[model samples]
Target: MSPTFTMSAGRPAPLGATFDGDGVNFAVFSEHARRMVVCLFSDDGKDEIARLDLPERDGDVWHGYISGLRPGQKYGLRAHGPYRPDEGHRFNPHKLLIDPYAKRLTGHPVWNDALMGYRADSSRADLTFDTRDSAPFMPRCVVEDPAFSWGEDIAPRTPAKDTIVYEAHVKGLTWTHPGVDAPGTFLGLASDAMLEHYTKLGITAVELLPAQAFLNDRFLVDRGLTNYWGYQTLGFFAPEPRYLDRGRIAEFQQMVARLHTAGIEVLMDVVYNHTGEGNEMGPTLAFRGLDNASYYRLMPDPRYYVNDTGTGNTVNVDHPMVLRMIMDSLRYWVEVMHVDGFRFDLCSTLGRVGEGGFDRGAAFFDAIRQDPVLTQVKLIAEPWDIGPGGYQLGAFPPPFMEWNDRFRDTVRRFWRNDPGTAPGLADRLTGSATQFDHSGRPATASVNLLTAHDGFTLQDVVSYDRKHNEANGEDGMDGHGENFSHNLGVEGPTDDVSILRARAQRKRNMMATLLLSQGTPMILAGDELGNTQKGNNNAYCQDNEISWIDWSQADDAFLDFTRRMIAFRKAHPILRQKLFLHSRERAIDGLEDLFWRRTDGQPMSSSDWEDPALSCLCVELRTASGTPLYGATETAIFAVFNAGEAERITLPEVPEGMRWVWEVDTTRPDALPGACCGATVQMPADAVAVFVTEVQP
Candidate 1:
């Protein structure tokens, strides 16, 4: 420690440790804290060098300034308050806590009984507090110098209508790649191989699984498994240490800058609804030790936490300082980290209020909506939790796109030839009009996807009828019970050539449905390569080969198909529209903006939609109704979706000097353009054929 180091009262405006040229200022929020002490650690972050009590308190914030302290200093906080569990106050000064606003973490928490404030084996369970120094077991927080040279970096700002999201994990995407020098790290994600793949696949943004600092739960450690998905977030502003090469924050910045250079935006999957700390018996981490009742939503007993998120404890987002903390973290990512967007995990829990309630006008929603920085970036919501009224599909307000599970289930049942699915498929193919047409939201309000990280892969969806999760150590009981899957004929891996061919075509049909639909399309990272978890839908704890993308087993044909489909979607403006299509007529063109039909080429009757035996659907898409003259176009598109046997389809009539050009045929992936279509055509079984109108030059 510097002999000239001296402490004095500091400003409490900024809530984290800030480094100035001459010194560092530290501030933390703890409403019930009697005293807040900043402990300076040795250069190795092992031994304590200095301990100084904060000399100032403004409202709930305690602050102090240490002169001659450099930017490379390492420190941790200790809060002193009453340890009354029944009244929701659990503070132990012996347990070191990480700052809620920490932008850089030294490492993860080392698992130990001393880390917990309450004895795990105690019969009284949290009613009794233990006194043990935990600084040796906890990772120290560092004072970071947030300086970077982002030369000529710029966000792509891709519109929601044209955006295609690729959901990936930092480790899974590159850990098995042959070209990445630093596997399972942020530098690997920015490798030339990864950037080239994203560009080739027409991906506009990469939605990464949680990249924030997280804890590997003690229970998971005891089970010999790991939290591979990183949902147990510990530090919001800091990048996950495992993803960085040398524990420097610049690696994350380098990744963002390089992705921007390739015209790709970055989206983070964030979990703000819960924390790593479990219920009453959980460890005394940052929030629990600083001010328990103010940070978490406690139950009536004030000892147990509200488990609305299915995680142990729900964050008290309704509290003003807690809400401010979340908002500040979000803004930091946008302003400092330069991330393009966020996909909130279990977002419904963020809106929970008193007495089993959910409000659309909640303060969290209103705050983000009004913030200038947040409104500009993309915001996707998972839209559900385990709490009351938690299934809030189509419930979020404007500027937020939601994950639409209805699209996934409906499309799966439709392609599986399930009865009574035609109408539901029609509704989904047209952007789920019944669910998203209200509140002045656009068709892009629903993010349509056939598969995601939590469910079966695209290949597994057609290859496994039941979830095989015995490998998860849960006795086949952890994942979803009903996956809406089909095995075609045989289960798991099969040598039958007939079953293999059917599975391939089935995969194409579903991917085609997703690309041609009128909404944002998100592809699971390795689905294009036919990646499988051996039918384990819940591989959240498997960080081994089961979760990693095996590049050696790449399915070239499916990869080619994915690339072509994304290009096809980008080429057609009529498919990606901001307005929803009703059967209403356009005033200027005197034609219906959208039309549906059966295999007979005639307009579909109400009975056709209700027909259990109906095996196909046809649609003609045009510029949406009420589109201004500037938004209208001359091109029109026609498509056929056949899930059953071969059939003949009549074409929609074309205007004078106009011809329908054969654009796509899933059965013949090598099919070329400029093939003129006739009035009638023979469509293959279980295939999609798309045509675009061109001038008859």
Candidate 2:
């Protein structure tokens, strides 16, 4: 490397390598580093041209300014300090590290032993230091121009009551798309074909599986697989390199603009709980090398890290700098990249501080709740981790939606005709009022999901009783065991028409139930087209055909059904409401906001709820009693959920000038509406039916 480049003391206001026309200002935080140098590379990013040490330090931050450097300059950092893994200070100057605020990277790291800070094979693992130069094996951060002409790109701020979230993986969604020109790239997802599909599907928002740059596990690579789901985040500010058609951040910006133009919001799944660098034995890529003790939550011994996320190391959100990094990353996505919101992965770890359990008042949550930029955008939490007391489904504060696992399990168990599920089903249908009703949080606070990437698809939920994850190379012990799913007649795939029909019906029932409930419904990407993983619930390691969406073999009927169902939900205001229905009588029409009934047309009693043989539940719904006059525009609605044998049930009576009209029937997809009910309606076995009030005049 050339030593000709000179450095001057620079201001340490905005961290990261900032190129401001004349040169670049380099600033990084390293509390224990003796010195830090910026290693500049050639245009091709292969040859090291110059190495200059940052000449000043404002508090804990190291800073320097280099003249005559341009926006496209490629560089890496090296911090000089003690390499004591026992005391939690692993500052190795030989291991090239990425800047924590790096907006773009040259490429992915070439996996090698030099990338590690210590000799992992030593008897005292991670205690022995290695002096291997790691610049040739690590990826370099590139100076970003930060200039994009976003001409008239307006964000589609779809209201929470009208949002239908479609969860999809960026590559898996576009890889096998027949109409996509550049498959498996961001541009492909924003292509005309994909946009048309999104608009036609009637989804207001698309919740993307992590688009952030991530690491492919070394062990998974050895077994001929990769980290396809991308939960292991390596760089928070950069987009995934594999998802780009050309090596540029502009491609990601263009994708966001296209989705916004189509009137669809984009929500990213973010992993801030932990990093790709696993444990003490893991590689020294970025954070572990920059400031190990300051960046991570170390254990009492200070040698090991707190593994609350089950991903080897939990981030120290309690630290002010660490919390600032997270907040800055989120704002960058919202302001610079034009993304709508984020769905935090393993969010329980972020809401916790030190040894205290998950708290809504934690620094991380408080920072986001009070931030001007972040409060305007949507924030969703995965709501749980492997840490103690981590299952915080409805415990999050107002304006922060949480992924309701209880909703998922309850819906599955109820549809499978499990005994004693009627009461649970009733609670879920009303947005689980017992859990989310307090703290002034609305019903939309619960992001109700029937299936996500972590578990089975809607088709597999009705076809496989247990998970089939043998292809993941973890021997069948990788995914969750109790799926609460039921295979009607046979396990795995079967051509039996009877079983196939039942499975399709079960899928429709769950899908209908989800749309009819009073929460934000999230549909797994291929559930509409009946995409199947062949019962593989956990396909995080399978990047090939096992995970990609097969467009050619799409279930046109079911897809049409899903589209119609979403449209139906949008058409009915009673289905998706902001307030919980508590059976209080409305002043405008003397009708109860919610009423539970039995087959005899009488209100449900305590004895009826306790009956184990009771498999049917009917509900009467209207606008909340406390709702203002402007919001009480909708009429009454009656729905029946029958899981037992088919029977005739009496429908609830309407007002003087209104009559009950058949609206939706999940048992018959092709069935037409506008059938005025008689004294009784035939409640189909294991099916759902909805009726709305109509004027007789």
Q: Which is the leading candidate under lDDT?
A: 1
- For model 2, residues 59-117, the per-residue Cα lDDT tens digits are 99899998878888999999998888778899989899988888888778888999999
How many clashing residue pairs, candidate 2?
A: 0
Backbone atom clashes (below 3 Å) for every candidate: 0, 0
Weakest lDDT window of 10 consecutive positions for candidate 2: 625-634
Alpha-carbon error at 601 in model 1, in Å? 1.5
- Give the residue spans of candidate 2 off by over 4 A: 585-591, 625-634
* lDDT per residue (tens digit) for residues 503-539 in model 1: 9888998999999999898999999999988888998
Report the CA-based lDDT of candidate 1 relative to the real structure.
Answer: 0.89
Give lDDT: candidate 2, residue 638.
Answer: 87
Q: Over the full model, what C-alpha lDDT does candidate 2 score relative to the true structure?
A: 0.89
